[model samples]
Target: MKFIPFYLIFTLLIFVQACGNKQVEENKTQREQVIAVHDEVMPKMGQLKSLEKAALQKAEELQNSETPDQAKIDELKNLASQLNLAYEGMFVWMRQYNTEDGEKTPEEVKVYLDEQLVLVSKVNEDIKAALAKAEVLLKD
Candidate 1:
């Protein structure tokens, strides 16, 4: 009877340890997924800055011209604003990122990462749109 109880305890302990290890592995995977999305989008930040600068210059030139095209200037201004917002969103997301809460678990990390993937996808799309719009405007 004593051996049976000890065996049950040992089995339970092993099961608990295995569960913990699985959670740790899951957390690592979730973290990697989040970082992957971030890495994919971060390199585009420089391009966004360049586009913003070009848009600003173009807008300034239009304003200084004898017959400024108000409509074009407004479009460029809007593009600049959107680019700024996209950059700001990335910066804010990085600053606010935290998955190490005391009460949080690996499941929570997975949930957070899943949500972040959607947000990062949208940010990338916005960056692409801004780049395309800026390119067409700068060409003219």
Candidate 2:
């Protein structure tokens, strides 16, 4: 059997190892971004669904009244604003995750998605808190 040169063989081995490392790094980043996206989106969706139900109920009651309580009206407006903020924030993160640029490096995309996820999650919490308060105010 013919023998391959030692340096050439070593260089090939190093190249293969580097390729594998790169793939592993890419996969780690992808998984992290996916998790972050999940955390942010699900809560926002939950907040929206919860608030929508509460608002619809109040709106229905208002329509039946000659004068809707001013506090309830204000509360509904606030809740609506919160909902829109969350909705818009979700779309922002979605754009990052969805790769609108089409040429963003995977790492850059992941960073943007991850950061957006955190910001959106915080916004979701605010929306949820606002929804809870609005529900009580409207019920009064």
Candidate 3:
């Protein structure tokens, strides 16, 4: 019968521990990235509401004008709707997002974080696009 030496067993254990720690660190990094994306756009919620209000008000004024530009009014109204939708999308993401690892394995948590990143990124794009359109419309 062959027996493993104490130093060999100890070295193997250390290697395994190091690998486990590396995986944990990676998962933590991914979680932080997801949170960063969410944070980046969170503060823009108020701006979204303000822009939506301005768009609706401008549309209303155009609607009431004697020589109503129906085309422009329609455009402004559409922009307002887009802004509102984008704002709501953020809330929806927040509601669905779970920060707790719970019983999930590390691989499951990784997959979850990846999905969250994609979802939050989409929300960010929507918000940015709506805001850009609103700014252009309001400027003119």
Best TM-score goes to which candidate?
Answer: 3
User: Which residue pairs show backbone clashes in model 3?
Assistant: none
lDDT of candidate 1 at residue 5, scale 0 to 100: 92
- Over the stretch 16-95, how does candidate 3's per-residue lDDT look in tens digits? 88887787778899989988988998999999999999999999999999999999999999999999999999999999
TM-score of 3: 0.89
Candidate 2 stretches greater than 4 Å from native? 1-23, 26-30, 36-50, 56-68, 99-110, 119-127, 134-140
TM-score against truth, every candidate: 0.81, 0.51, 0.89
lDDT of 2 by residue, 33-127 (tens): 66564565565576676676677667667857998777766667667667666656666655655535256565565566666556656655655
Q: Return the top candidate by lDDT.
A: 3
The per-prediction tally of clashing pairs is: 0, 0, 0
The order by descending lDDT is 3, 1, 2
Per-prediction RMSD in angstroms?
2.3, 5.5, 2.0
Superposed by TM-score, candidate 1 places the C-alpha of residue 113 at a distance from the truth, in angstroms, of: 2.8
